[model samples]
Target: MDAAPMDATALLLADSRFPGGGHAHSGGLEEAAARGLVTDEPSLASFLLGRLRTAGALAAAFAAAATGGGDLGALDAEFDARTPSPAQRAASRAQGGGVARAARRAWPSARLDALLAAQPRPHHPVIVGLLVRDPRDAARVVAYLAVTGPASAAVRLLGLDPLGVNAVLARLAGEVDAVAADAARHARTAPEDLPAPGSPALDLLAEAHDRHHREEVRLFAS
Candidate 1:
């Protein structure tokens, strides 16, 4: 029997089809691919792997914290500081703002919706943390978001076969599982002790994409 509270429901919320504005963001891969930071399938795999390894790690921790009902304010601050580039920060907020708008209207969780309205929009992951039923599920939510959101965006950018992307994601299913487990474990940390967000290159990419505007536009602006 399924033991998870809102497990099926959470899956629905995180589904790419929810129209929560995730479709609009390419997770900086659009910019990376155009700039040749990512070109072929191997590069695509590597890029996702890197993100899953570091940013994914931070996200896991944050989700865990959220599930655990840790200090959201501190997590919010940590998220802001970790995101160094102004443009990437803007993009993150943009995505967050949109998601907040949509989720508030559709799902209507009092705790989460109230938090969304509290000003200085909570980071997307944090906002997501609020909607989910428990603090322990944050990492799973992040993994679901990380995999689906980017994979959906990648389909639009690369014109790569859809089946291939699904296959790729499936291949990394173990990695995703591990990442989620780590994030959940880290969420157990004292709010003060949560791991800082890593991956300077991603921040740099978002910042660079914001400036190096050209014809081949991908939505990931720093």
Candidate 2:
């Protein structure tokens, strides 16, 4: 694909406004904020970085892998293996189903429809990967999601300056590009060989949030 077209596609997929159900989720920032781990800008930045490195990297790899039109069912299973938290898994599938519905309307790909019908609720990264044809663009989409979701959450949950939060995302843009490049390199690798980086703290937060938020009303979904 041409550079301009590739970037445009990536931008469309990365847009938070794109009906991907991302607004409902905070990438576990809600739980961290409730626990006082991300009380301020610096702490929030730390949490975002940790998420970008672990969850972000893994999502990018699987997204890149999906761009190649590999076995999406197997890829979804691999994503489940990487994600230990059932709540997190459900959130991913929720977002995935939403994105799949939107992608069918916006992009209208037979492959996307088939994948969605087979899994019903594929992982978020998998649907995103199948939307864009370029593996690099797919990686970029996942990397953008990794930071933007939490950044938005910080603004709503902590009342932090939106400008400052955007700045945090801007500062990490280079790192996002680097992570996407690394993930793109592993597109041809076996799905099992794809990175399975996990964040124990985030997983624990998700589990706790799932249980606690059942009774208590929470702002974010997960």
Candidate 3:
């Protein structure tokens, strides 16, 4: 059977209801919210914006790389090396493992099940890209996934109004587009050129969250 082109598949793979385990993650927003860094709508807006310019964009690049027949192992290592904390890596791997199992069931194409089956582990963004039909399609799926998980995590972590976070996504539509465009550009850059600089405060928060022993902690530092 022929595969669908990038544009059509982009919508399918990026859907919030994609049965993936992405719902459990906050893309590190849970920690941010806990620290009062993203308590309300405006703060949420700024946090989302910062995410786009940094790690979110880097995820876009990895998704693009995975989409372009790039090696999954290489992408995994690159993402891992860029991540500053061990807890962040563990969280990502957990998400990636969950999503990879989901992909083996959902798409089952390009021999993805077997491909993921062979890994030490699959990264969420890498698996996310392969689920789509092309790099361009992968870009949308990963970007939307990156933002939504964190936003969802925020709502639960802070007890913020659910409708408000959705509104945040709705409000950040243009910024999302800007991030996507930048993601596309980064997709083609050398692996050495990928963005690795993340917020120092965010990193510190994640590290601190580990020692707190809270039942609601969701700090995935990287």
CA lDDT of each prediction against the hidden true structure: 0.70, 0.88, 0.68
Model 2 misses residue 150 by how many Å? 0.7
Off by over 4 Å in 2: 1-5
Instruction: Write model 3 residue lDDT over 69-89, tens digit each, in one string.
Output: 666666777888887876667
- The C-alpha RMSD in Å for every predicted model, in order, reads 2.8, 1.8, 4.2
Q: How well is each residue in 122-205 modelled by candidate 1, as lDDT tens digits?
A: 677777766674544657767666666666667777787788888878777778778776676665577667777678888777
lDDT per residue for candidate 2 within 1-222, as digits (tens), equals 224446676787798888777899998999999989999889988999999999999999999999887888889889999998999899889988888778777888789778977998899999888887688789889988999999999999999999999999998988888888888887787887788998999899999899878989999889
Candidate 3: which stretches are off by over 4 Å? 1-9, 110-114, 186-188, 213-222
Backbone clash pairs for candidate 1 read: 60-183, 67-134, 67-135, 67-136, 68-135, 87-222, 88-222
Error of 1 at 163 (Å): 1.4
Summing lDDT over every window of 10 consecutive residues in candidate 1, give the lowest-scoring window: 213-222
Question: lDDT of candidate 1 vs native?
Answer: 0.70
Q: Residue 121's C-alpha lDDT in candidate 3?
A: 57
Q: What is the TM-score of each candidate against the true structure?
A: 0.86, 0.96, 0.82
